[model samples]
Target: MMAMVTMVAFALEGYVNFVGMTLIERSANDKESAAASWCDYERKGTRDKVKDLRRMTGAEIDWNKRPYATIKELNELRNMFAHPKPQKPKVREWEAVGTDAEFRKQLRDYRPEYEERLTWEFCTRAYDDVEAIWQHLLEVAKINPFDALSGGSQGFELLAWVDENGRETRA
Candidate 1:
């Protein structure tokens, strides 16, 4: 039943995972080559604080896990939408439809909890749940203010420290 929730959540936001992957690759680089990376050379003018965060808090992240998790979720969602859809015999008015006087009588069997959970309310809750997963993503990636579509203006703030020689220190 709960698995159904995860499936729907991913189905709804599968595009975000795609966008995030592209953004991460475009923004991130290997630690050794990071001096020339966008986050360093170009972005420093904007997110200069990230440099300090690295030096003081050692906030460097792996960056690989988040994309992997998002891709996995997208796969699960595609399966759910592409799989053979169960028949939900439509009901009519006037006299009625299906069997019982009630039109929706055919759907009484809720053995498969997933079918029961197919509601707007459930989808909304599922969205919140999936978003929660990414909360941890930002923390794990050590990337502050993880707004990918924000054009790099917003994300976790980086710390900066100027040593006695007035040189930037790497944390």
Candidate 2:
């Protein structure tokens, strides 16, 4: 039972960090995207379309137009999970494993959130939220040109180094 509890806690932390890492990487893409669009508008020379694009995009999207702030926050959250955060404790690190009262206090002080045994339902919800953010990042990165052509669901796709023409090039 203790092992199960420990596993679940670590899983939760991992999922959170996974989502956070994606978000952080996405922030870079956001900047890239804004740069792409500047060329788009510059070439198209359509005032109405440019106005429409601004309207369609979020307010946070500045002249370059990307959610850099949100991405930065997500990266920080990921780093917090990736390192041994003294502020949070894993289930296996319970103070009961030690005889000293100091250890017990340390455990409780760190993982104060787990007032009860962490449940699947709780973990599932957290995972779901992480998934949503990840999906959004994929959409923004435009990982799949086929999806762009088809106008289908913009799921996450990775791009390798590309030739000047934007075709996927060999490493």
Pick the TM-score winner.
1
Tens digits of per-residue lDDT for model 1 on 139-161? 54444544534565554656777
Whole-model Cα lDDT of every candidate shown, in order: 0.45, 0.42
TM-score of each: 0.34, 0.25
Regions of model 2 farther than 4 Å from truth? 1-112, 145-171
TM-score of 1: 0.34
lDDT of 2 at 135: 46
